[model samples]
Structure formats: C-alpha cells, structure tokens
Target: MKAKVYVTLKPSVLDPQGKAIKHSVELLGFSGISDIRQGKYFEIAIEGPLNVDQAREEAVRMAHDVLSNPIIEDFRVEIEE
Candidate 1:
C-alpha cells in the first residue's frame, strides 16, 4: 500500500515562498496571477493491509507528529491499495 500526503498552509496563513514565486511570475510577464501557495508532497510505501480508515488515521497522526506543524499547517492523506 502507499499513502500520498499533501501538507499545505491553511488559507489564513501566509506563504512567503508562494508570494515570491508569484512575484517572479509577474516579472516574467505572466499576467493576472492572484495568488499561490507552497506545499509538501510525501509519498510513503507501507507493508500493511489496505484499510482506508486505519491508513487515514495513521497518516493524520504522522502528519501531526512529524510531517507538519499543526499550528501553521494542515495535511490531507491519499491512500492507494
């Protein structure tokens, strides 16, 4: 089984890296770019059974424990059988 986790800042949070990228895009002549956000993608391979609920729990726990700072970020999990 595999899990793909995407960790991103909440909409209320500010992403300086994303802002910088947006600025660069504008400088390069890309018009009407309103916003951008930076995030992390983690692909994990597991040896356990494909229990979606269990995997989601584990993934959320992992996100809280190590993958992200709960104070500033949020995470979503995608599990593959």
Candidate 2:
C-alpha cells in the first residue's frame, strides 16, 4: 500500500517562510497575490500484511505522532492500494 501525506501549518500560525516567498513573488512582478501559504508533502510506501483500512489507520497514527504536531500543524492522508 502507499500513503501520501500533506502536512501544513495551521491558519492561526505565522509562517515566515511563506511570507518571504510572497514578498519574492511580488518583487518578481506577480500581481494580485493576496496571500501565500507553505506546506510539506510526503509519500510513504508501506509493505507487508496490512489491509487498506489498517494502513490508513496506521498512517493517521504516524501523522499524529511522528509526522506532524497536532497543536501547530494539520495533516491529511491519502491511501492507495
């Protein structure tokens, strides 16, 4: 099974990196840009003996425990068999 994870900062949090990118975009002459946000993308491939539901459960657990901090970050999981 394969899992694709997307991790991103919460809307209430400030992202300096995203701000910098937005500034750069403006400097590069991109107009009408109201806001910018940044996020992380992860693709994980798991092997052996697990059903799709089991894999999704395990991936969500990992996202909460290892991949993301539930306080400042949020994550979404996409499962493929």
Highest-TM-score candidate: 2
* Candidate 2 residue pairs that clash: none
Total clashing pairs for each candidate: 0, 0
- Candidate 2 wrong stretches, greater than 4 Å: none
lDDT of 1 by residue, 1-81 (tens): 788999999889989999999999999999988998999999988775648888878887898889998899999989888
Off by over 4 Å in 1: none
> All models: lDDT?
0.89, 0.94
lDDT of 2 at 72: 94
lDDT of 2 at 19: 97
Worst 10 residues of 2 by lDDT: 34-43
Error of 1 at 7 (Å): 0.7
| Alpha-carbon RMSD of each model | 1.4, 1.1
